[model samples]
Target: MHNFLRFFPVFASTLGVVLAVPLNVSHTTISPAPSPTCTEATTTALPPEQDCFYVPPNGWETKEPGAVLRHRFAPQQPFATDTVNYPAWNILYRTTDSNGDPTYAVTTAFAPKDISTPHAMVSFQFNYNSADVNESPSYGIYHDIKPKLWISKYLQHGWFVNLPDFEGPLAAFGAGHMAGYATLDSVRATLKMSQIIGMPRGADQGVRYAMYGYSGGAFATGWAAELQPTYAPDLHFEAAGLGGLFPNGTATLEKLSKLQMSNWAWSSNLRSVMIGLGTMHKKIREVITSSLGKPEWDWNTVIRRLPQEKEVSRLDLKNAVNTAINSPLVRNVLDYDTTLGSHGIPTMPLMFHRADTDQLSAPEDTQELKNVYCNSGASVFLHVHPNTWDDPHFREGLQACLSEDIQTFLATAFARRLYPGCGTDNRPWGDHQYGPIGAR
Candidate 1:
């Protein structure tokens, strides 16, 4: 593994940011609109803000979770390749929210033209890192080239790729259970609609599924893994690759508040998190307003708006972050909702990796989670990258994408192999089931 690190390409450039443009989109249900007609000219056209495909039909809640509500041939966006060879579809499905209430979400499925029998499937979560529904991969995937390239790699391997907007329609970004439900339901929708999405017959049963996510994406993946045992017991994952895992919400906010002075970007991220969390938990809004006194702005309305809106002043952002961190009521809600590892240990094997010096998510938190899983008898392989750069958070994330370690881990898991060369100086700890190579 160390030898592979030297060959990884340097990705010093930052990812492209999706410009936030406010739109008049509604999350509530409306009268059903006609189905979309997918002509060659309309295939590449972006979905309008009021695209009826997103609106759940009346009585949609009566359907079971993971039931396909609507689906359309999606635009081959973020990639200018031939749609015939790499077809994609947008699926709106019924899923539960953080409160376990019936809700709806969307996911994009990409597949190779000729899928092999008993092929592999990868649920690749993208790190959109925003609290805006417009920034979701289903709509804004065309803005970033990195996610497109990653999706293409999986397609090149003849694996179906499922990209879920795990934040749901409300864009409740930091709500762990909601993200988990959406992620798992997206997979369910893909498998349930296998034939509709052009998969070979009986493909669902023979498909070997794995998941990969980094940074904010990892937050969703981690939560889904933890919640899969009870929340979605019908589903099973061959392996899960979680890099730069966000373990504790409170700890993360405290770390960001301390670093916000040096990097204004960190302050922006702090504000986004607060808004994301506030969307799902009313306690967060109540505590912030009570601790800081009623602000000139309406907390309820503000939480519904986009995070990048200038309506929120810098002073308000600072005060909200401080109140969220200090107030016991807000902290309790965050501890229960935003944190990972409290739910349950995943049954599938996990490949965990992170930089030794990640600024956003502390290294100790990842190690602590690994300890919890290992102690619970779960198969886990923990890899710690060397802190060679100033911004290990970004550099290590790029390394995860550039290196073949994740692919190798998934392949080993798909093959039901016990060891995938996980033991080394860099990877000092793994569960007994996946012991060090050559230790049998």
Candidate 2:
């Protein structure tokens, strides 16, 4: 809305060229209706077999609620799953990196119970994975344990779900933003697989789509929404829901480095900063000195090995890890200001939720986004939770705030009706914003 970037329709074909991802397509026979083919411009061919739309085979015995198969989003490197009832499959797939290195992703098809209903698809990306850099260790474990708690609420009402391991195969730091590309592609893959599975293709032709995520997953979902209109015009999206959002990577990194007094958070913050630095800055290690440093390892090493550690506290944060992020050079490189609205914000309805108690992510992160969006003549409804405090931590509170409402909101948004629901701190903050109790 701030006109941060020019709006350009990104047909799937154009994105394939820009990303250099070759496309392929194929067919399978397990579906209830004929699947759809790529109607949008696309350079990549659909995979040769509809099974390319993976569904995990063994662990999840297919159910009659019309559950299609999906491999556990993440199990290990070089992971895979198989197709089930729908000709489409679900999988944690792999593709070549820019350097031809294999990268893994969690990809799957849209499976609806009552195959006859015109079900829309939604992808709910899970938050950061402290364990693996490329794999969504968090999503993998959560999905395995709770198949679709959040999404099931939607599928029960006639919606398909396509969750992706956006961290690529490496689960690297800034991979959060890149997860958007993976989500869009996986969505594209879903659209194709739905067609291959022989599900009612036209049932969802121009069907409404919505994306929602919190924390790390929020980063991916925001990016995907930002990229969708231009990157995959053929795949229509109705709206996007982003909660506990981080608009400027650099800003969050700076705040974390200066707040080292906080124990549990500082290490993870440093870890994220290291990942961001690894992704964006090249002169990091050279700017860091070995002595008088709080970082655990030289800048280069931390970036390379983040995924190997199961926990951050055990990773020796007293060393170079802390110093690296607070390093003037690293901060200088990250100081560049930016916002989600800098790119074209989503074209459809937008819902952004932030917590007042969130010290890890400054309130200004979402505030600046609202300013950019509203100023751009875009209509966005901002929701802030006063119960969310600055110092106490807001992740758990945020999850409790909307796990169920998000599903309901998606259903209503797709239905083009006002969403009826209740949440803590639902009162408005000002003209259109919500929250800022102490600030008020």
Candidate 3:
């Protein structure tokens, strides 16, 4: 592990030189229509409700998964600070649901205008962690500072960043399979639309790919890695970086339900999970709503209206936590979606960054995940951060993006260098005095 870390600076410099020279591939530029179909001329900004772009065209189901159904120049976001004015597009593409039924999803693709040829691509999944369609990345990314900062690093590297609304139109937050399908299919759509995004035609096959996510986003990234071998065998990811992972949704929910009694914030987390699961599975919804009694009739009403209102008060969330925790059917649905190892092991190298004191996701769960992947002969690197005074979950996620180790991992993968074998680094960041604890 130490040897690999020592080689990163040299690899990174070589990668920069390689990326500077555009690929010697044929190019064909396609002009975007001045006025895209299904767009309202009067409205400058179209939310999902009024945006016909979110809806699939007729016969969309006949198209193969990841096929781009419709695309248009994305409306200018107030918070979008692209000084170079990179070409950005809102793409509607074919994808599948958690049940393997044909469906469509939207992805926001940002391309570096200076790059004439395809380079590496990063399919970044956001942790909106909500059941509200309005809060999806396609609509909310520009407004949020954290995501913008996280995405800028990749864009600055001249890599195409594909941000998919992985929760789908329904915003089924906890449905890992659905998120996986949306994520992988988003990559396909980005590749298919390369020419339109200022890359050469047929450059999709030449592009290196990677995936990154944290917290709820990691839930999708982990599933995408696990499902890639079978679901999207044609695509290959050089590396995947997951931080603050929710390894088991069932355990997370059960833990949240028990803790919510004392903490108001935990109740909010429980409500979000319950609403997200209810949106995906009808049986779970029935069980949750059925558990609500006359005393909590208002709580039931609030849950029913959450999709539209997209807000819940602390009091309302507190009233509903018990209703979901006690439902067997809800637990059954979560149990089915929670376990990551039930699916096949990932073929790509994986980097996991976790904090020992993460409040939302238990550190033990991440250890178990690493053990499962290592036992199955998958390459894994686990970096453990020491406990902190502040929220370790949020801090660890931030540290992941800013860490030198993460940059080295991505650089090593993109350069096609030999990745370190399965190992664990328990030393805190900047503690270079000690070598990695567990190297195999």
Candidate 4:
């Protein structure tokens, strides 16, 4: 989730910004696109101007979100049936105001493309916004770009992609539970949009609705899956996939300070810790005020107070928690017995992929998640990679594995009661009841 590589130039005594260009071609081969009716479907009542959508007052359909605003270049290959990869008339909208809660918008490459019925729809949970001022160029590389890439791939399969700005009005980072609800509602809004447009979404027939996310996405996915059974029971989802899960935020703070990735992790952890402490514990407000020499704090105010590298070096996280514990504002919640207090249970199937060598998120902690839901009797699969450290977070391989596994699992998990390929041996994967392989 954290990119430690950004700091390399500081030690090398050179200063320059390096642009990351995606591979000229995607390495992972994708499935072919399905045919659609010749008649074009139309978009329904458009969302207000502020929201992200297909037909905003001004929008670009070809470029992905977080991309440098620039002229579009034609893709070398043609989309199926000569459909434009970046259609000229399609609209891309952004919605921030959803009454009071935080919300964001997303539109596909071809909004009005013909699809009589959709097989699945995926809504993404965006990570934190590190950029200081709204509309200013992002200070850090925009990591929320993955969802756009994923949406491109899903569109090839005729599935709709939904992107949600989970940060609400204040852009709440580390507010895991609230982020979850916002993500779910965004999906609901998309479904409502589909209905309004007369597009058929197989949500009632249990159309395979899968939730896929990485890191910040993982947190949103975890909370969404946990809350869906109760919150959005009418919406049918087959599976939920998560990778680079920073699930136990409290535990992660305790473990990651000494890791090689600490340089990057510290910033995210500090932001999340402060936000979580402030949002979850009422008493924490008083302590932070007394210790930091401030009268009150808001999201932006607290984020600005975050320590720089040198100051953070002198501070210890566990000790900080102790101080927070004594703070009149956070004492009660901090003193509350367990790390992850009893929360809602997840009703749908779950797929978690983790690499053994992950520095940002421990694989062991991820494996333990299966045990948490084992009693509920839901279908769960835990895929463990052989400690690959390709990504700074040690999660790139794990993210791919989770994506592939979830795709295969949902295709077969419910109807056939079958699991996809799994295990180090590369043998066939069986249902949860049978495990990946049978020795007999």
Clashes of each: 0, 44, 0, 15
lDDT of 4 at 237: 74
Order of the predicted models by lDDT, top scorer first: 1, 3, 2, 4
What's each prediction's TM-score? 0.84, 0.63, 0.81, 0.62
Q: Indicate whether candidate 1 or candidate 3 has the larger TM-score.
A: 1
User: Worst ten-residue run, lDDT, model 4?
Assistant: 23-32
- Looking at model 2, residue 352 earns an lDDT score of 72
Best by TM-score: 1
Question: 209-312, model 4: which lDDT tens digit per residue?
Answer: 56777666677788778767766676667667776676666556555444313444444445444544454334455565444444565534554554343333
Q: Model 4, residue 285: what's the lDDT? A: 58
lDDT string for model 3 (76-158, tens) is: 64234566555678899999988788888889888864542336778888777766666678876655555676677777777
Which candidate should be chosen as best, given lDDT against the real structure?
1
lDDT of each: 0.71, 0.49, 0.69, 0.44
Candidate 2 per-residue C-alpha lDDT over 278-387 given as tens digits, one digit per residue, 9 for 90 to 100 = 54345665544342232467644544444233433323444444555577766554443123555565666677766665655777767777777666655466666555
Report the lDDT tens digits of candidate 1 across residue range 1-440. Answer: 34443555242233312211111222211112223642222455454234666777789999988999988888555455545357778889999988888888889998775674457789988877666666678876765566776677677767889999898877777788988999999999998878877665453557888899888888889999999999899998988988887698888887877766566566556656766777677666767655444444466555544244355555655665777577787778788888988899898878777788888788788878887887787777777776767767766666676566676666666666644333323642221123442223
Error of 1 at 378 (Å): 0.8
Where in model 1 is the C-alpha error above 4 Å?
Answer: 1-44, 76-78, 82-85, 114-118, 201-205, 290-294, 300-316, 419-440
Q: Candidate 2, which segments miss by more than 4 Å at Cα? A: 1-88, 91-104, 115-118, 131-139, 142-148, 196-199, 203-206, 258-260, 276-339, 388-403, 418-425, 428-440
